[model samples]
Target: MTQKTMSSLQRVLTSLSHKEPDRVPFFLLTTMHGAKELGISIEQYFSQARNVVEGQLRMREKYRHDCYYSFFYAPIEVEAWGGEVLFYDDGPPNSGAPIIRNAENIKHLTPPKIEETPCLLKVLEATRLLKNEVGDDAPIIGVAMSPYSLPVMQMGFDNYIELMLDQPDLFAQLMKVNEAFCIAWSNAQLEAGATAICYFDPVSSTTITPREMYLKTGFNVARQTLAQIKGPTATHMASGRCLPIVEDLANTGTAIIGVSVLEDLAELKSACRGKLTVLGNLNGIEMRRWTLEQAESKVKDAIARAGSGGGFILSDNHGEIPWQVSDEILMAISEAVHKWGKYPLTWLEDHG
Candidate 1:
């Protein structure tokens, strides 16, 4: 029997449920690259809600990838807490400095009010606009920094590790404040029209810290925060290795988790087989220099490794495409995925 054609929504949903649809669902995850497409500076592209929505629409037109990413730079969230955010000529903005100066600061820390934060409000408005425009067309993914991982921005990496190890109580206090902020911010996006929220937690990866550390702090925070989120969510570890902690991540109530390029894709798929969906392993950092052939080969290999069943969503590993990646390579990747990503993937044996 022949299968019926599926919409992008059906494709992603079927894959999320571990069922093969007509084709494998994939998204480009072109975050700041959208700004690059608009021929505008990152600062200008993110200045207004319409600019982001327009960039997304144009990005889809050019790449034709599934899923609309309704996200702004991550550090913008830190701005809500009074952290200075510095934009750039290339890539996303970075926190100017750690917001927390000392351990006592954690005790006095409070969640930033989302409504009162302008940058956050613009992001929420962008989500609402995208939903109004293509709400039924494809998945709209909203992003939130995980409470456990946000500490890296709250304090410097070294300071956060010290606090996590030497002073558990202070870390807990920080998590409490961040947790409230995360839930409220995430729900606001969902209400604005996000299909699911992406919990970005790079510091939770074992590559960033010991597996034991993740188990103790990141795991519990993820579990608790995920419970409070009103909608389905995905746990993403940026580009860091997640396999050592993938099993623990499975129990965190997330529908999916973004894998990293540093790990083996086949094993990651096998590990996530029935538990949750796998989102990627594409090496975005090096994509700027990839030729058409390299782009095609990598996409083909990734699909062949993880696209057998429906529990896969292909995307760049690090979540955001660097602003430097050119149009030709990205277009080539999309073409390759569409060529080999069809259900059954029987073409692999003859050609690949």
Candidate 2:
């Protein structure tokens, strides 16, 4: 619909993959507050498909940041598996009950066929709208659940973990089914014109045994789903330090790994080497609590430490910052990265 010389998404994607750019990229992970701050209501935006697309377009124009997520969430994956959700006024939707409570319930589980599921179809439409409207100005990143997380949707967290310990075979079978669902779902987004798919598999990193990560999930289903996609794929590890499994994860060969606070961003960069890109670890709460200058400084520091070799893209260490994060503070963080972040150790002298 509109055109610009250089947009945020293109810059970040190029730099993070180790290519040179006009400058280091400034990428903000969007949250409810970011939308509201831009004059859109979070409730109204996420509820409707057009609203979601407009909201993202508005964000890119306002912040001029490098990338934006597709405004889709992991709960949608559970919904595809026949799970129900209860929405709230304040935060994300929560799954009401596991679709597959018992092994026998597996028979009833069917992945939502794209046309048949209104919620999912809405996302596909939103993605198409974004890809067409934004074009190359910004890269639209899609999301899919890790095979490990699908079980938590089918069977609650406690049940899924116990099954991993007790009935390993059933767990693997469930993962395979979910993996197929992911391949289909992610491909739908890619075909819809997404530049990349952001895969969330916090459960595997947080709860499962490393044995499960390696022998069962890592080398098998997760790799299989990643292999199915032609475009870039990113895996977001939600919980604490997933460092131990980072190498095995790198072996899966996704293009980016989204890191949380538990992860040492520097170590993650070192481990992935040239094989993968590291996305975040900004500590959202800290960003809110500290002064804008302090927050900006932290962002600069993270970029310098993690982005040194060039595969690091900046984002908060955790989920979206709360709705109260001030526009000035947000702007400060965004501006700091673009101003201070550069190649060949931009902040090295300041740090030393």
Candidate 3:
């Protein structure tokens, strides 16, 4: 079977349901490298609706990624609340300063209105364009940050973590406020045609002090925000330090769990134990240095091990598919999936 005979929506659901399809599905959170390689500046691409649509079309035609990401993040929403962002020429923007640095400042803080933000509106327009162009060709996904990431991006991570120590109540209150932002922004993207949303929180990993992550972050409020999204959701942490929190992450009720470089597919598969969909394991750092054929072989082997069950999807631990792989390498990955991914056991034999 070929893509001409199937729709992107069908492919997603089919994979989620644990059934073998003509080819494995592709999903991405966001890709800065893809944007840069395509020669579209972030400002120019994000400024107009057509630029956003064309960028996605080029990626779809080139890599055949099954899902299209809006390339927006939660901090952009904070910008609406009057926070400042430092934009870069080649990657996602960074926050300039914390909007609320002290527990005492919490009393004066007011959440930003989603409809009024400039950067956020750009994403809304992109979502609308995605719906119009590839509406049924591929599912579109939007992103939001978890409480751990939201506060730190709005207020410096160190400052916010200190507040957590001096006053636990303040930490809880801040998260409560941030949760509202998540709901509003996620709802807006859903309305604009997002079939799913991703909540990323790499800051609360095990590498940080427990007082900062586990107690001050991670578990409790994350549950609340994940519960509010109307569409399917995935919890993404692109850091190796967070592997210890896997069980706690499993409790979030999200549809998928996206792990990072620290964990391997075999480990993730064992940890998830069929409780959640596991979607990663290709090592971005290692592949960046390998030949295209070597990279494709690595991805294929990962699929054979981690993708054996119905719940796994293939992807790199972090970053976009590096341009070094070229069209030929990417096609090799697709071809391998088509050849070896089907179920009903094509080659296995019984010893009886």
Ranking of models by lDDT: 1, 2, 3
- 2 against 3, candidate with superior lDDT: 2
Report model 2's TM-score to 2 decimal places. 0.90
Best by lDDT: 1
Write model 1 residue lDDT over 143-193, tens digit each, in one string. Answer: 999998888887988998899889989988988999999999999999999
Q: What's the TM-score of every candidate structure?
A: 0.97, 0.90, 0.85
Clashes of each: 0, 7, 1
Deviation from truth (RMSD, Å), model 2: 3.6
lDDT of 3 by residue, 1-352 (tens): 2344456677667777766555556664344544554687665555666666677777667666678887553457667778886767745666777777566787667677777777788888888888988767788878877766777777777787687777788877777778888888888889999888877766666655462457436677778888887888877765444556667777777767777756567777777765777777666656546675675567666766666556777776653454344455556665555555544333323311
Positional deviation of 205 in candidate 1, in angstroms? 0.9
Tens digit per residue, CA lDDT, model 2, 109-186:
566687788878888998998888878777788887777666777788888778777887777677777777788888
lDDT for predicted candidate 2 compared with the true structure: 0.71
Total backbone clashes of model 3?
1
